[model samples]
Target chain A: MTRILPALAVAVTLSSFGSFTASADPLPSWVSSGTKDQIVEFVTAVTTPDSTDYVTPADRIAVFDNDGTLWAEQPVYFQFIFAMDRLAELAKQDPSILTTPTLQAAAKGDLETVLQGGHNALIEVVNASHSGISVEAFQAAVADWLDTARHPETNLPYDQMTYQPMVELLRYLRDEGFQTYIVSGGGLHFMRVFAEEAYGIPPEQILGTYANTTYEQVDGVPTVIKAPGIAFIDDKGGKPINIERTIGKRPILAGGNSDGDFAMMEWTSAGEGPRLGVLIHHTDAAREWAYDRESPIGKLVDGLDKGPGMGWVIVDMAQDWSRIYTGAN
Target chain B: MTRILPALAVAVTLSSFGSFTASADPLPSWVSSGTKDQIVEFVTAVTTPDSTDYVTPADRIAVFDNDGTLWAEQPVYFQFIFAMDRLAELAKQDPSILTTPTLQAAAKGDLETVLQGGHNALIEVVNASHSGISVEAFQAAVADWLDTARHPETNLPYDQMTYQPMVELLRYLRDEGFQTYIVSGGGLHFMRVFAEEAYGIPPEQILGTYANTTYEQVDGVPTVIKAPGIAFIDDKGGKPINIERTIGKRPILAGGNSDGDFAMMEWTSAGEGPRLGVLIHHTDAAREWAYDRESPIGKLVDGLDKGPGMGWVIVDMAQDWSRIYTGAN
Candidate 1:
């Protein structure tokens, strides 16, 4: 599928990212470093017809993990914060919800105490805040929240807190004929709300954890109600499973930031021919929150240790990225 | 996103399907009939920027159901035949499988008796035949079977049994900048093997029923092993659910051939803009096997009955389609 070009022409195309012209820098936010070079080299190799690693445009699938990889997950995941804020609002209205143990922890913003309840507690919070409403109502609610809600640490809207370098990488990939997809652990609808505006990935290409939905006719209007139960989890090993279930082909490129992404990376790297696995290590404390290997959310211990041996690229945020937050520059 | 082409240019573009020339017939196999005209009208309206019903190219999602609609599903669903053939092969190797009642029924090609055991029995058959194998191995098996297996009645390869007119429609829509997807009740991987080659729809765009898969390492190789459990069922109410789960947006156009597609049609028609619901009624018994209303497989009762009231285009196969099968001149 690759059109033959002269070596000089190929070099010009590689240097140009957004415009696809001769001299535009695709990853301007990305510093001229080994990590950036690695990304460019892999993309160029797969897209070049004469290269042994050439892959067709139809097969140029790139999956990205959302939480920490695309945006900040510090001081608890942004979705958790949304759920907590929602719990607070609901508690004020219901009053009775305040007495429930799990709801009480969530209302108090005590995620640690809520964690004591384990996976069920998280599911309960997610269900209470995310489900039982119509899909439209939920989407509207999320839209409203995201419009006003600011990250506690950054004081910027959650959408604006998306990493600048990563955003550029997404654009660059898309410019190069790769169909970019967000294979996130976040709620499917939650990501769909801002994915197109933030990442340039359309809703159809966004695969994520989803709640069960029931189809029904309400007053002559067809409606899909979000049911109060988890349908599919798009995390850890489930990531690879969901990718296969949704995409039907093994992705040539995948990026993530935690131990949860190890299996996804493993699955992508294990595919035949050329494949690229990227692990984003949060090592910028001054610019952005830096906690890895021991962080409660988005831990990166096993991935950091195993990535090098597996030929996966470990992107040290502080060193590899010239910019962190999109809001910064 | 539609450009305001000159009236002459618009007519030329519409006439030319593949080359975008002035004289090529987009639906050559499709007779110059009302059904074909209706399709052309819908495509033009949606693609015309000046038209009130105009939709952007990004939102121009057209979903097609496999089986009876796109291909022949007369003697039995092709996938079922593959399963039966696989069961026979397995039974020959392991005589003990014949001792089990469901396996015995499957091996004898008695789907009715196997279905009498209910949904669980069907799942058991699918698992016994399709699971506990690596994804690559399963794909290879399906590929090998497709290469040799012939339709019992048609004696044509299953892929060749596709409707040439419908194939033309797929290309026409794609040429008009619409993204085509196969939303089928067939297994996800099963449709994927032939979807791209037959319909020009890639694996990522193919949405269907899927089995659960587990990610694991087998002798230092990463593998996604298909587990012995039904992950998702993409039929009836499940179709709308899976559509939202996978596509994240309601499609503008949907085509199907059975009562199983009613909810999908309802979902598409209920969306906020101009939408089209197409029900392909099998009425050509001479050229193609005709079965509807009372047919055990691919039943078209409710859809044929309720489709007209819902503003759906009920395509009479004998009248609307000039050609039934691809193999037929």
Candidate 2:
């Protein structure tokens, strides 16, 4: 921990240099474009003390979707990849665990076959791979997997696949007294393992689809074991509902990349205050994946069609982002 | 808000003066005794730079039960009172809403009858009164009720019934970089309404028993409406389960007054670190209600029987508190 401080110090110094410059940019990875300008303007308006649009520190809540908005979700949602990987490993140990068609498909890495089986099949795969273990054991498994696994295409560690500009935006918002949260359709426990380290958002702030967990005394020690069922799938309308349920406040700003996040951004826009809705458009095939409207993961029809009319800033990833990931372009 | 600032300024000045004194106490409402010393020592050890128990700011989580622990919950849990009052109000407008015996009993202020009906009946009354309302509308109703409603015995506003020492402890813990959260069996929306003002805890930090709410476009705006059913009862084993589900980390400190909080404290204590469990034993009948084991609400037999053995500090309200409520002896 002490040894890593020097590297962190150098990074901070480099970031601080951008802040000290005449034309300073807190989000240095974001291009000097309309998208960046809109984000900066919204933050400035809300944070400026004398501005009519000014919001208090406590009310300065911002919610961002995890998969596509904050990080890359190209061929599939990364959590699904984790589930498939986990299932494959489990199947190798005990082939009997892949009892169902979907579980077997997932174990065989047949993404198309599993997707064709629909929501129930997806849930079966997820539950089989994710549940029936203590939360601590599951967390340990996720941590271990993340440490060794890399993105098939990027060859980068899965956690390192996070968007640089969005990471900077999160830091910038926190600096401006905004409470940043991840309202995702991803697995809660899986995201929690890396959210703090990768995104600088704490465990409590990351709200996502969670499994039904039971509290029991396992070997006389209190343990929360993940049960084999989805308690809630935080997608589409579920995003806003979970946001209100957890945060109990309408976020002033919402950032997302798909139809799943449409309601959240809509809710944020409906609040009678200075609100901003940012939709990250995956239009960068050179640096990142560019499938949108008809994408298997992160489908963006509603967001692409109705977002602009709602005064939401649609981020053209290829145009707006100068750097896709940290230390990479 | 401007009118209240001068009073707030004076309170801050007065509180600051204590820090400047030779033997000043941050928790002046608490007696300078073992209980107070223990709390201070635990915080100090975790905060000190070179201490073996030094916890980072992000990991310094503290959870407290809201009902009997942070505030007074004597005659009945305040949320039950709120539910009863709400039912009565609704029944006045439309008597048909009181379809069940439980609802009718609650509407008529028959506390004994309502209590006799048990958990399902209690839930029925709550569901009847609390459901079919938007989150914003429900919050407004709770805020209005809190403003007008007073404790039957003390005749003070329900929000003001919060214990002074506990409030100070919350502030002190926050000052020492601990993120304080309320984990209680109270209505989530009800507690969220006044939590910030009453206890300095933000809405997001307050976790409680929640109803199943549905999100819909009421008119043209996205609205979260409370539906009729208890989604969770955050008591006993559920406390630790919800804590892990929401926070994803075991708290360093757990504070409560009843057996409902036993699992939470046990979970906190079981974590590998310097942890503290504080049981607020309501032993002062003169200043506050003192029923424990035989009490309908906030029964504390397990806490009394096993807390000390678990290294938990038992706070005797009669002896430990110099002041019970703020601005009252």
Task: Tell me which residue pairs clash in candidate 1.
Answer: none
**How far out, in Å, is residue B267 in model 2?**
0.6
> For candidate 1, lDDT tens digit of each residue in A62-160?
999999999998877788889988988887888786656898899889988987887678778888888777888888988999999988777999999
Pick the TM-score winner. Answer: 2
On residues A266-320, what C-alpha lDDT tens digit does candidate 2 reach at each position?
A: 9899899799999999998989988887777788899888888889999998999
Give the alpha carbon lDDT tens digit for every residue of B105-153 in model 2: 8999999999997777778888888999998899899989988888888
Estimate TM-scores for all models.
0.92, 0.93
Tell me which residue pairs clash in candidate 2: none
Over 4 Å off in model 1, which ranges? A1-20, A116-119, B1-20, B111-122
Cα lDDT of model 1 by residue, B126-155, tens digit: 778998898888888999998998887778
Query: lDDT per model, in order?
Result: 0.86, 0.90
DockQ, each predicted model: 0.71, 0.71
DockQ of 1: 0.71
Worst 10 residues of 2 chain A by lDDT: A17-26
**lDDT accuracy of residue B171 in candidate 2:** 91
